[model samples]
Target: MAKKKNKKASPNTIGTNKQARRLYEILETFEAGISLLGTEVKSLRGGHVSFKDGYVSFHDGSAFLVGVHIAPYEQTGQYDQHDPERRRRLLLHKHEIDVLQSKVDQRGLTVVPMKMYFSRGKVKVQIGLGRGKNVHSKKQDLKDRDIQRDTQRQLASYK
Candidate 1:
């Protein structure tokens, strides 16, 4: 008789953050593990989280994720529900944390959330160190995008 084949369940892989469709520039992206409670983890698995208010800060040789909201589990009650807007710690190497800290201190770079996803059953947040876009720069980006879209549409029509 042949042995039965056992199949392992697939690990969850999905983005849980607002994607910037027209990101003018992406400087650097860092993979950092996120600290989450049981309920928070469950909420992320549902995949409706937002990064509109998410930002990262370094303190005491570590980076912390601030303003990242993970809503409470819908089926849970208030007794054991953790704060949805709690500050979560980001797990990164000591050297990497130091580098990010130095950049923020020396330069005027800002830490912004690029995306959030699950890897090997652990939730991870990708942070981007970026310089803010000025008004004219943003307008130029919009115009460039519009031109690209128009070009693509014309090419499609000709084909």
Candidate 2:
């Protein structure tokens, strides 16, 4: 018998933060380029990225991604290994960065990384500006989701 290979040709999405939608009300979204090391990119391609605590922050007139974890590539040598928790710089137009900064400062909003994916062979991140949802609103959203699910099941049964 021949051994099987589990490797996929290519994956569309690298990672996603599922809690972003449930914890915050997204106001705006922007696509930004991420600066990654060679090994980090390989790790991402292998589905080893995490976004649970990832967020975007501005410093020195530039944007940086914080808390996003990319596991080191398994084949990398010890001398060339990259830090999993190092802050990565984000590439965006100066005007966009200014706008994001102003909105975040004035409205007390947060910038969170919603998803990471490959676009034309380049890694990109979808950043969302969001306002934290309160407990009551979260409950309402859960209730609405349940109702929609129940309606979908009913419609399916009727058909």
Q: What Cα-based lDDT does every candidate model obtain?
A: 0.78, 0.94
Q: In candidate 2, what residue range of length 10 has the lowest lDDT sum?
A: 4-13
Could you tell me the C-alpha RMSD of candidate 1 in Å? Answer: 6.8
Q: How do the residues 12-45 of candidate 1 rate in per-residue lDDT, one tens digit apiece?
A: 5445443342342557888999888999888888
Over all chains combined, what TM-score does candidate 1 have?
0.85
Model 2, runs deviating above 4 Å: 1-10
Off by over 4 Å in 1: 1-24
lDDT of 1: 0.78
Question: How many residue pairs clash in each candidate at the backbone level?
Answer: 0, 0
Compare the candidates by lDDT and give the number of the best one. 2
Which has the greatest TM-score? 2
TM-scores of the candidates are 0.85, 0.92
Tell me how candidate 2 scores on lDDT: 0.94
Candidate 2 scores a C-alpha RMSD against the true structure in Å of 2.9
